[model samples]
Target: MAWVQFGHAKCGSREPTSNARACRLEPRKSMSLDRFGHSTPTCEAWTMLQSMRRHSQSFLIYVLFGMLIVVFVFMFGLPSTDSCDPQTQIIVAEAGNFEINDSDVKSGTMRTFGDTLRGGDKEFKAAQRQVLYNMVTTLLVAEKAEDAGFRVSDDELRQYIVDWEKGNPDQLRYISGGKFDKERYKNFLDYYGLPTERYEAYKRRELLARNYLTMLETSLVVSQVEVRDLFEKRMNRTDLEFIKLEPMHVEHLFEAPTAAEVNAFLAEHMDEVKAAFTANKSEYSTPAKVHLKEIIVQKNDKMLRQIGTETDKAKAPDTRFKILKKAVIDNSMAFDEAAEKYNEALVYRANGGDRGTEELENLSKQHRDALGDKKVGEIVAFETDLTYNVVRIEEKLDATETPLDKVQSDIASTLIKAERADKKMDEVANSIFERVKNGEEFAAALEAVLYAETPAEVPPVDAVDPTVVPDDANPADEPKKAEEEAPQRVKVDVAETGPFSLRGASYGSWSRLPMIGDAPELARAALTLTEASPLAPKVYTVEGSRVIAKLKKADTGTDEQFAGQKERLIQTIRQQKSAALLGDWRSVITLSHPEPSLQSYGPWVQALFDQAQESGQFKVNQAFLTPSGSEVAANE
Candidate 1:
């Protein structure tokens, strides 16, 4: 037979040619011998091992394929960075060398507008146009600041943040669904594409801008005179001395009126009633009010003893514990009464342990619910820590109907006084108009008429001159009348002597000594002196009362007193000029940028204009309001 020869176990054998060869057979390299063919056993074994290796390789390949599939599912299948749809755009405005963007507008304002228009699909689009003007203005200011090379230090920014956080702990409630929630804060930042670091940076920039403006304004001088003048002009400060007429105390005038009497009064004075009502509807409208009260029974040692007694009954060893328990339960009925009568901490003791009426709003929630639908004098019970409250509904008011009746008496009284006032005013005005026209000296005529009409006497000689009186004079007897009689009246006169400066004009008019009306006329006349001018009496009449006043000893101090005000005036003048320029520029800018809107920023812009006018820092550009109602360019 033709046999394959293999050296050193190169050939596979069922029984090795040597024992060593059988132990270490080279299966991969050997050939198998069979009855039908000359094939080596090592060859078959090697083929089987190769098949097993291929299966293992296939398993690993499957695992790698699965891992790649999982990675793709986690990557593209999950939420993408761009998935949250945000319709956002940032617009910028250039102010000289620097630029500012939409983000410069306060976040609060932007969010408010957003929330207001959130329902409609086109809201965002509308908001873009509506917000553009304010955004541009804010951005321009911010950019101008940047160009000025103003920067806030990190420490300053941190301090400001701490201050803001302290002042506005409640603001966090709005930022986080009314809770101190971290996730809400994070979501808010994430939605705006801002991290904590960027948020702080923005806040610091805002603080810096505010500080810059404050520093710019405060560094300039503001005089006491300037402040006082501003206060005098803007604030309505009047020194009034009048006894209030109380109808309630003087009940004899209105004990009981027949229906016909009331009707006759109403009918005779229809115009007066209408005028009073028209001028003062507010006085006739009643305020929303509630009547509520609280009963407080505080816990103290006596109550603690009672509680201990009950506990002792429950824990009694030899005594009849069940009987003691029953007795304690029966005594519990009077626990509230005991608290009111004997408890040291009880606050209410009078009116059968009653508390007075309190406002509904002031009542606690439980108290309000307890009082629901209860009528007057209806006693209801509620529990407290140490006492049971027996509350009586003392009063209730229907919102609409109740106010009308409550204010009717006030309305009627107001109407009557107003009628008296108008008639008195007309009488006084006509008198003044006639006296001035008749060549009567205004100040002299005022004092003479005032003294003649009222029971006011000149001050006593002792009051006027303390040094002229003698301590040894008789206590009861009066001094003998002098042969020279007292002057019946005093004369007042006016003079034009003044510093005659712009600063003087700002204080209205000044006087060292001023005349007064006789006591009866004094209170009425003060209200008529709304404006100060060349010396003349200011006379006022209200409800049979008359007052007379005259300017005396005028002193308009020099502008040296307003030295500190000069710098502030200069800045205010500059701001006025800038504002004027802005107002004029707005028309042209709005026309150019028709897509955006410009709103009326009133009072704020107008205040600067008014100040400049009064301070003589502004020139009237009469051409600005032309016959054709078109604005013209102004310089100054």
Candidate 2:
């Protein structure tokens, strides 16, 4: 490459025959050839450069055209508003075709999340989050289950509902507690502010989700060992002493008073009757919490008579009634003011016609009947003894507590019962103690024993009591001949019974036991048996029953025997392990997920667990989870 000199400055040197202006640039071109392998622009390269320029121009034009279309769409065609703007939409969430409106979100109601959780605390947001999570999770899980072909069948659902109804006998209380019989269900939904269908849908989802989870868990086969182990751990595990008060006979107090005897007594107690009248005058008085305004007649004597007549009738008023009514129809003034204007001779009218605190007892039952129909500011007309009585109730107290005077009879009855109980208990205690001293068992001495005898006929093999601990032979269980088998109950006619203990119960069907309520003493005696000194019979008194318990036997087996039963023992051990796992797992699952819908438990199962949580039957166990996830139980 050659350099050109221009005004003492070094420039590319021009070629010998080349133009000087072009030569300055021509040397730069030669430098390009050093970088590549070409010196000057070629014919083929020029054509390619022109084609590249054309392609670039085409791409640019396409991009600009697309931008123009987008701009146009955004400026004129697109819906221009925020999605969450309250003014733009009536609702936010939708369940199927149903819109969740602002009205659905409790505003000023007492049941609002604000009222239930926060009150006025900043922790309200956290509380809201918890509620939202639970609600959403419930909805999502149910939805997923439905998608997976899990559904409640009509027959199964109907049976489930029947069982539910059978279970909750007191469910009618939720149905307006005996107000309107026909509208009970409707009223209940209204009280909760829920549409009936919506509530049903919610329940369906919740139940289906629960059923799905239950199906999953139960399909998990807990072995026989597990079942037996759980049974052992649970059975006879709870140690509790139940103290029960005996039911006293109250019929003894009332020896059936004759009608003639009562009449003669009433005659003799005429002064007492007068005293009773004086004592309960307040009870007789109808004291209603009535916001009262009295309206008296302000018409001619003839008109008053006509108004009085119309008030007594059940039918519509006549021309004379209309004339009298129009005379008192003061539309502009308040009812109270109208009452004052109309009332002239009435008792309340003299005092601004405001019956401040009218005793309901003072009014006749019929007049009082119409009082309920009258609102806080409306005139109700009804016939009284003297004249037409039009009254407005400012307020009403439906029914107050019974006065002390009114309940005197009840008090007298209760006192009589107490006195009878005192007298009877002394007689009962003496009778019981004397019988024991006379060498008779306490249970045998009691006239009415709750513990009944087994039928003479042999009962079913499974009908034997599971809780009854069997008696052991003092000499030891001998290996008797194959023909000589043991009898169910031991006959100890002459020989005193051996040491008593709850060694173990025979596998018997539990439905055949005598009605023995709260056998605490028997349980105590059974629990405290020993071999050294055989305990004597202890008459343990418990609720609704007495027990005569004597120790039969108490002994531990040898290791040789344990070795012989080792295989059975290991099976037992395995079962115990399985049971333990089931118990722990059930406890965990039940605590986390409980059936809140089932409020009450059956009698047999009641002893197994605490009652439904929210009812305050069982204390909250922070350490334990109840069957219903509604509460954390505090079990000691």
Summarize candidate 1's per-residue lDDT along 31-93 as a digit string, tens digits. Answer: 111111232222233333333444555778667655654564454342222211111312122
Q: Which stretches of candidate 1 lie over 4 Å from their true place?
A: 1-133, 139-295, 298-346, 349-352, 357-365, 373-379, 383-417, 429-534, 537-548, 552-560, 572-636
Count of clashes in candidate 1: 11
Which candidate number maximizes lDDT? 2
As a whole number from 0 to 100, the lDDT of residue 52 in candidate 1 is: 48
RMSD of each: 26.4, 28.6
Give me the candidate number with maximum TM-score. 1
Q: What is the TM-score of each candidate against the true structure?
A: 0.37, 0.24
- Candidate 2: tens digits of C-alpha lDDT, residues 384-423: 5445555666777665555544544543444444545455
Worst 10 residues of 2 by lDDT: 25-34
